[model samples]
Target: MASNAFRKELYVFERGPEGKPVMAVIRNYTERDFDGLIRIQQESFPPPFPSELWWTKEQLANHVHLFPEGALCVEIDGEPAASITGLVVDFDPSHAEHTWEEITDAGYIRNHKPDGNTLYIVDVSVRPMYRKLGLGKWLMQSMYEVVVQLKLERLLGGGRLPGYHEHADTMTAVQYAEAVLAGELRDPVMSFLLRCGRTPVKLVAGYLEDEDSLNYAMLMEWKNPFIR
Candidate 1:
């Protein structure tokens, strides 16, 4: 069992296979969750994404050690189903061009800053089996709540443009993103993010190694208006 120090939570989700409502538990991940986290990462990002990009034991450990509050996990039926990892950083929107490694300290979150005003999301993945359960949205909401509770300015992430590759030949990454926002195009990542209340700030390149995204991503952010 994990410690109570972490923010343990229960979120009711859509009905399960039996047509009965199910409950998912959200909480901070610990050292023991490394294997499960690794499994999910592989399941989420397969061969083309580069196996080396997967989470390392050291990275997972550093996440919990440096900032337990930012390390989140989801459990359904006592099994790890999804996870989201992030760190706090002092973000400058005007000068926001950066690769994932620079922002997240190579996934170890060694760059986490407690006094920073932004919650920088580094990774979010859900098991294929539970994708239909709406766990992704719930996980994001959990992080948004963290931003509100910490009195942060906003929550942000370099969201991959997974559907960009399809339109890459005819349009630029920025144009593709704008089209998605305009409802003229539907991108898996961009559409899901928009539905989650995140607004795209700009299109960034070299954000990560997602071939489907053509190594480009849109910087998305959700401001915490209640933070004064």
Candidate 2:
């Protein structure tokens, strides 16, 4: 992959006097961007979320070494604002059940497949201050562009239901997912993904270790419309 597989100047957006739109650069991350990504993970997932679960230099380096095209980052005013990491997988939709650790190789993404038909999004990190600025959808779009460029069949990943823990007692994980789908509930990650055009395929348990999602997440996918 080229060093600059994809790069775009996107205007950061917000409303109601919170801020003005800032010119931001969205492009693939290199080795030097690892520490900034770590800071992003720190701000993105705060306390109670294990800091050890965050990206390490080795893992980030592995990402670039294995599949440089998949390691992308967003910069606003030359600071790392957000990033999305993905790896190709020759996926079998019939055998989609797998833990995050199993598929992602614990975020090291050692299982990356260059000839794979599906791009499995491993992680997305954004500094807390960059949240709610429509960055997630752009990141999703960036990956979707990747899928299209590679002629991949689809973009797939686990979408966390961070809001479910608050309603766990009232509903099963599946039911909580259904509620979110039906517009009866709002989940930070799930809702954001939905707005970004991903559809929930099913709910899976032990998808990842997250206090908010209770280790449950929705198996989501977005098909490439340009393909067919």
Candidate 3:
């Protein structure tokens, strides 16, 4: 229940107390925005989902009218620049085997809180050239403000390292694993989370024998009043 004023005002990004034109605003996704979202995802993620999987008229219909609550897009001058998909889930740090759906469906995470609740942030991506400009961090803060208006308790994100296979010059799976082990690996989205005061509590390894490499899945958490 973010205030109408806050939601409306969120479109602008802050740059050292000055509003910059490069700011991104969060809005509901539309069919026209799908292609850009897909392109950004393809470039940002390894093994991205095929464009056909998501860029469909049917998907657009569902996203706009149905589950649009957590489907958010950040736009620059009304053009999509970044996007995120988040869902509130029951967080069970102990259940390593449970998929995201299972945890939420089982009521391990409560949708309605007797008091304060939590906002479980899912996927987030910013267009490559736009990195480090604070768009990602601003979007996250906007979500936090939304949760606060709704009196939610916390925020969370599933962090992952991009895993790829080498066909020629690339080291493929081995490089992915090495990066995970060496601590040289980092997820840009997760790094944004850290700048906003999140702590990584768990790391799940992503491995593909065919590629012969390993990736990583990290779990990060942040509570309200991010600055304490």
Per-model lDDT: 0.87, 0.87, 0.55
Candidate 1 lDDT over 1-228, as tens digits, reads 324344566755555665456677898988888899999999998877688888989889998888888888998887789999889999998998999889999888888999999999988999998887788888898899889888999999988888899998999988898899899999998899899999988788888877889999899999998975
Per-structure clash totals for the candidates: 0, 0, 5
Better of 1 and 3 by lDDT: 1
Residues forming the 10-long window of minimal summed lDDT in candidate 3:
207-216
What TM-score would every model get versus the actual structure?
0.92, 0.94, 0.62
Residue 75, model 3, lDDT: 79
Q: In candidate 3, how many Å is residue 93 off?
A: 3.9
> Candidate 3: deviation at residue 186, Å?
5.7
Q: Give Cα distance to truth, residue 13, candidate 1, Å.
A: 3.7
Question: Candidate 3: deviation at residue 210, Å?
Answer: 12
Per-residue lDDT for 189 in model 2?
89
List candidate 2 stretches off by more than 4 Å: 1-4, 17-19
User: Which segments of candidate 1 are over 4 A away from where they belong?
Assistant: 1-11, 14-19
What does candidate 2 score on TM?
0.94
